[model samples]
Target: MPTKTLRIPTTDGPADAFAAFPDDGKRHPGVLMYSDAFGRRPVLERMATELAGHGYYVLLPNLYHRHGPAPVTELPEYIGEEVRPAVLARLMPVLEAHTADRVLSDADAYLGFLTAQPEVCAGPVAVTGYCIGTLYALNTAAARPDAVAAVAGFHPGFVVTDAPDSPHRLIPGLAAEVHLGIAEGDVTPEIIGELTRALDAVGLGHTCEVYPGTVHGFTMADTDAFSAAGLKIHWDRLLSLLDRALARD
Candidate 1:
């Protein structure tokens, strides 16, 4: 595998990002991976590399580039119990600043750059995210129906928020296949019902399920909530969706 630190040109500014792709001289499907509120870091880089190894050109951009580059805030090497509060404190404002409008604007730029990359296959791409990144991932797929082929999210926050611009509301615009793995206990039955109804209204290919016994942030190995079984479930679902979507293109 090959990795590079790159700058992605966005409407807001030049976003500093990290990318990984197989070293083999062959173009692969592009995957735009959005990081959680924690921003781009080692855990995300490792995840991107793993995805690239599975035959995709993975790009992980700093969603908070409006604030600064990667490491937008000084995060502890690991988000342990003691440092969790401080990490959230620094992350909350950035999360708040990423309004729906901002997310849509950045999504346009991200998909544009991703599809244009020399290493990427010239076709529809996949988008996946964690936590708040999930909101952006869904919105990105909805906003660019022609470019995004699939959208998958894990442990997403604000999917059921009171806000009118919540990701669930935009489900109708999604032209891509959708897969959501909700954290066990994070989403109530009422919220799940609303989400499923929204997806049904769209009449798109989709699957929404709660991973058994997995708490929020289950895919992050550095988090206390990490669940190996749940993470494997996520990988299986996501890769299958990607294969179907990318194969169509």
Candidate 2:
């Protein structure tokens, strides 16, 4: 596999990004992978490479690009119990700074960069995200339904919120098949039912399920909350979803 450090021109500035593809030298389907609030790091790069090995061009962009390039601030090797609070404190503000308008603008820039790549196969692609990135992935797919064939999120919350612009509100706009790996206890039964009803109401193709025995951020390798079982489930669901949604001509 080959990984390249690149920049994506956004309204705010040039957002740093990375692209991973097979070394076999053939164009493949494109996947825009949104990083969690933790931002980009070596672990994310490895994830991108793994996805590329499955015959797709994967692009990981810095969600906090407006602040600066990835690792906008130096991230620790592991966000252990002692440093976890401090890491959240540093990241929360950056998370709050991203307005809905900014998210929409950035999504356009990311999609533009992915679809335009020479290594990416032409036509509708796929999108996947983690943590709060779930919102970004949903917004991106809803915004360009014809361009995104599948959308997946892992341990993503805030899908069903009191906010008028909640992610579930955008379900009707999405043309892609959607999958969400929910954390245990993240959402109440009523909320899950409500979201499921919403997706069903729109006749959208979607699967939203809670993974048993998984806590929030379970798929993240660098966090103490990481669960090997949950991470494996994510891989199985994501790859299967991608295979079904992005089948070649």
Candidate 3:
């Protein structure tokens, strides 16, 4: 895989990002991968490369570029349960500051930049997210239904909310096939049913299921909540969703 550090021009400023793609010199499908609340890091880069190796152009951007580059706040190498609370204490303000308007702005810039890359083939792309990025991914897919063919999220957070503009409410606008691999207890059965109903109302192909024996952030290897088995299930569902949605005639 060939990876390059790049900057995406957003309404706020230039957001630091990176792209991973095959070295075969042929254009490939594009995937916009949103990092978890921890933001971009080695693990995310590795994930992007792994997805790239499967024959797609993967772009990972720093969600907190407005505050500064990735790791906007210093992070411990291993986020054990004891250290996670402290980390969240420091990050909550930053995460909360990223309002819906900012998300929409960044989504436009990110999608525009991804599709414009020479190595990315023309047509709709896929968006995948982890943790809090799930909200972002859903927002992006809803905002750009025509530009996105697939949307997948792992251990998602804040996607189903009571707010009038909650992500679930936006499902009617989405054209992408959707799959959500939830960590056990990360979401309530009631909310999951609500999300399913919204997706069904829109008549789109979708699934929202909780991964057995996993907790929030189960797909992140650097987190104490990481579950190897859960991660495997995530990749399986994610790849298949992408394959079915992005397949060309």
Candidate 4:
């Protein structure tokens, strides 16, 4: 795999990002990966490289570039239970300030830069995210269905919120196949039904199920809630969705 640091032009400013791709000199399907509220770090970089090894061009960007590059705030190498509260306390204001407008602006810039990469093939791309990035991934897919062929989220957050602009409410605009791997107790049954109904309303092929015996943020290795089994399932679901949607070789 080959990886490179990048600067992506956006409405707010140049976002610091990274790209991971196979070193085969062949253009591959593009995948726009959104990081969780934790943002970019070594864990995410390794994940991107692993995905790129499967024959796709993966672009991971710093969502809070307006404030600064990733680690917009200092972060612990491991976000364990003891330090989780402090991290969230420091990050809450910054996370809240990232409005939907900013999300859309960054999405456009990310997709534009991703599809234009020399290593990326010309076609609708797939978007995948973890935790809060699920919201970003869903928004990007809905806002540009013609350009997003698949959208998958794991241990997702804020997808079934009461807000009018909730991820579920954006289902009508999606033309892509969807898959959401939920964490146990993270989402209630009633909310799951609501999300299912919303996706059903649009006749979209989708899956929204709780991965067994896992807690929120199960897919993130550095978190206290990390579950190796859950992470394996996440990769299975994600790769299947991307392969079916993007037709990568």
Task: Show where candidate 3 strays beyond 4 Å.
Answer: none
Q: Quick one: ranking by TM-score, best first?
A: 4, 3, 2, 1
Local accuracy of candidate 3 as per-residue lDDT tens digits, 130-221: 98899999999999998999999999888888899988999999999999999889889999999999999989999998999999999899
Candidate 4 residue spans exceeding 4 A from truth:
none
Model 3, TM vs. native: 0.98
How do the residues 37-99 of candidate 4 rate in per-residue lDDT, one tens digit apiece? 989999999999999998999999988899998889989999999999999999999999999
Cα-lDDT of candidate 2? 0.89
- Model 4 pairs whose backbones collide: none
Give Cα distance to truth, residue 118, candidate 2, Å: 0.9
Candidate 1 worst ten-residue window by lDDT: 240-249
Q: State the lDDT of candidate 2 residue by residue for 1-249, as single tens digits.
A: 899999999988999998999887678999999888898888888889999998999999988988888887768999877998888898888889988889889989988989898888888899999988889999999999989999999988888888999998998899998899999988888878987898899887889989999998998889888899998899899999999898553
lDDT of 1 by residue, 1-249 (tens): 899998888887799989999998889999999888888999889999998988999999988899988788898887887889889998899889988898888888888888888889878999999988888899898889999889999998779788887788888888899899999988898998988899888788888899999999999988888899998999899889988988522
Count of backbone clashes for each model?
Answer: 0, 0, 0, 0
Q: How far out, in Å, is residue 186 in model 1?
A: 1.1
Per-prediction TM-score to the true structure, in the order listed: 0.96, 0.97, 0.98, 0.98
Give every collision pair in model 3: none
- Over 4 Å off, model 2: none
| Full-model lDDT for every candidate | 0.88, 0.89, 0.92, 0.92
lDDT of 4: 0.92
